[model samples]
Target: MARGKTQMRRIENATSRQVTFFKRRNGLLKKAFELSVLCDAEVAVLIFSTRGKLYEFSSKSIKETIERYKRHKKDIQAKNPPVEQNKQHLQQEMASLMENIEHLESSKRKLSGEDLGSCTTEELLELEQQLERSISSIRTRKIQVFRQHVEQLKEKGTALAVENAMLRNKLSLQQERGSNKEKATVPSADISEVSDVETDLFIGPPETSRKRAL
Candidate 1:
């Protein structure tokens, strides 16, 4: 059967932990040296113990390796610049925006008659004039709207009156027609009178009839 894998955890015994540290440090140094020699590369390693003991490895002078590493980092950073300049620009823009906002807020407050203790006579007069102009403009707009509303109401009233008159006329005409129809449907009495002359037996003789006719 395969052996179980060793669990990677801290050594409970202080002596064992120190021994493990020494062994790992030696192994790491040996690997660093081999990598630098075989690959012809610069290498550096630094390690510190819990008790403040220092351990290090460098293919060349440790100072030279540190300086070279710093230069390489600087080159990489130069290749892709940081956003410090952009951040500064954004901060300046934000500050300017905030200043404008504050200025607008102060102006609004002053217009509302708040914080007026610092106003000079000229400023007060100017503000009053501005308010007058604004009120005049508002009143003018309101008057125009009211006039328009009145005109609309007048038009609606006129239209309603005309409709009412037409309805009344139609009703009157319908009643008149109905009355005429009823009159036509009823019968009327004849008012002719008879003559009052007498027609007695006058068939005696042509001479008598002629005398009577005369």
Candidate 2:
């Protein structure tokens, strides 16, 4: 028996819906294959059941058909690029576009505002919490920067301490050398004292007369 005419609507009965889906799916695929064979033309069909199962058919490879479709779209666009030429009509479209843009902008502005009159209490609290978190993050970054600065200063102090210690050691060594030189050139007693006075007076060797006097 032939099937009766069916209403154009969702089939509420699960079994009937499933049977219909199977029958229609097979029929569509058969018709697609027949068309491809008869016309010597590429054909591709993609179907999805209500349950989300996929069915696909292509005379040539699906990828090739998709690539050919894309090339055709591009060639058509290149041949006749759509343009809005009439200024008044364009202005009317622009005015409509501007109205939509303004409406969206106003909505964005309203959402960004702090006025909680129209917003739910939960949303307001969430916004406030986010702001607090942002502030906390900023403060944490600030503290980290300060800590880095302090560490840099501490490193500089350590370097300066080492340099100061080296300078003090050099000064002490120079002072010790001066004291030793003064002690090594001490004067002898009596007439040697007189030669010593002469040697102290002059940096050269003691005079022969002074040595005889000693």
Candidate 3:
């Protein structure tokens, strides 16, 4: 005859519940032993009855199995750590960034002449003096740079003037040499004319010479 499936629930009778506990405990231990031996695996199982009786099974020493479990849990936690600590660290970094951003914004507002209502009279005076000092420094540096630029220009002008003088002197010397050459040519032509005239006078008029002899 086919029997119906037994309903899985707490047994109401004390004796029946105790009998079920014993049977289930023995079956569980037998299954664990078979799994370890067949698969060559390390196995551990623990059971506690309602009356606080402890039952356990282990392929090796229960203490060794417990230690191994603890080590495996630690390794898993190290590899995939809890999110709460990372969340806290990120929150702290976000708060610090927000504070820095706010500080920078406040400084920017002050520099732009906004948010002045919060400043005391002394702080205003100090800010004014600091601005004045910055302006003075900037103006002084500008003037120094201008002076340096002007000095450079003056040096350049002086060098150009000296170069111009040298060019003019060289041109004047060339012109003088050219003029001297022209004058030397003219003198040579005059000397040739004078020589011709003297020769004619010395050997001229044979009739005049015969008259003087007679």
Candidate 4:
């Protein structure tokens, strides 16, 4: 009959677990020894029992193996240089960010008009000068914007004046072309009435225009 497969699980009983650990440790040490002798390969194994007992097997000095492992790790790290550079860059960025945050906090306190009680007279004067310069800059910008707006209004006014002159010239040309015919077809009083209506429609009184502008 074939033997049943052993279930892979923790042995529940303390005595059973201890026995298993002892057997497995011995088996592992024997395997390491055989592997080193038969294959002529370096081998190292380490095990720690639940009771804090240590078991180890090494084809050569364990210290030599550990040092080799450490050197191998360093070689791998040296081969990948970007990892260390990126780590240092990230550290520098974090430090810079922290410094920027502190500066911003200090500026915020100054802007809020706080933490000035301990300031020296020279520092206070410097802060006052900075504020004055800022206000002057703001006022200069405001004046520039106002001038731009006025210039835009003047451009629009010039365009309107040119359009009005063109319209007047067109009206005069039409009037000159039809003057004789209009006189023959209409009475003098009716001509005057039409002229008054045209004037009122095309050209409002100057005082009214001025009031509206204001």
Query: Judged by TM-score, which candidate is best?
Result: 4
Candidate 3 residue pairs in backbone clash:
none
lDDT of 1 by residue, 1-214 (tens): 9988867998899999999899999999999999999999999999999999899999888999999889999998888666996788889999999999998998789899999999899989998999999999999999999999999999999999999999999999999999999887655422223544556668688788768877
Better of 1 and 3 by TM-score: 3
Candidate 3 regions exceeding 4 Å error are: 1-84, 188-214
lDDT of model 1 at position 44: 92
Q: What is the C-alpha lDDT of each candidate?
A: 0.90, 0.84, 0.90, 0.87
TM-score of each: 0.49, 0.41, 0.52, 0.53
The CA lDDT at 44 in model 2 is 96
| Shift of residue 176 alpha carbon in model 1, Å | 2.1
Give the distance in Å from residue 212's predicted Cα in candidate 4 to where it truly belongs: 72
Better of 2 and 3 by TM-score: 3
lDDT of 4 by residue, 1-214 (tens): 9999879998899998888888888988999999999999989998887778888889998999999999998998788767779899999999999999998898678766898888789878888888899999999999999999999999999999999999999999999879978777778767677673322332588888657556
Candidate 3 per-residue lDDT, tens place, 1-214, comes to: 9998878988899999999899989999999999999999999999999999999999999999999989999998899777997799889999999999998898778767899899999878887887899899999999999999999999999999999999999999999999999988998888887773323343558888667556
Better of 1 and 4 by TM-score: 4
Q: Which ten residues in a row have the lowest lDDT in candidate 4?
A: 194-203
RMSD of each: 10.2, 21.5, 10.5, 18.3
Candidate order, TM-score descending: 4, 3, 1, 2
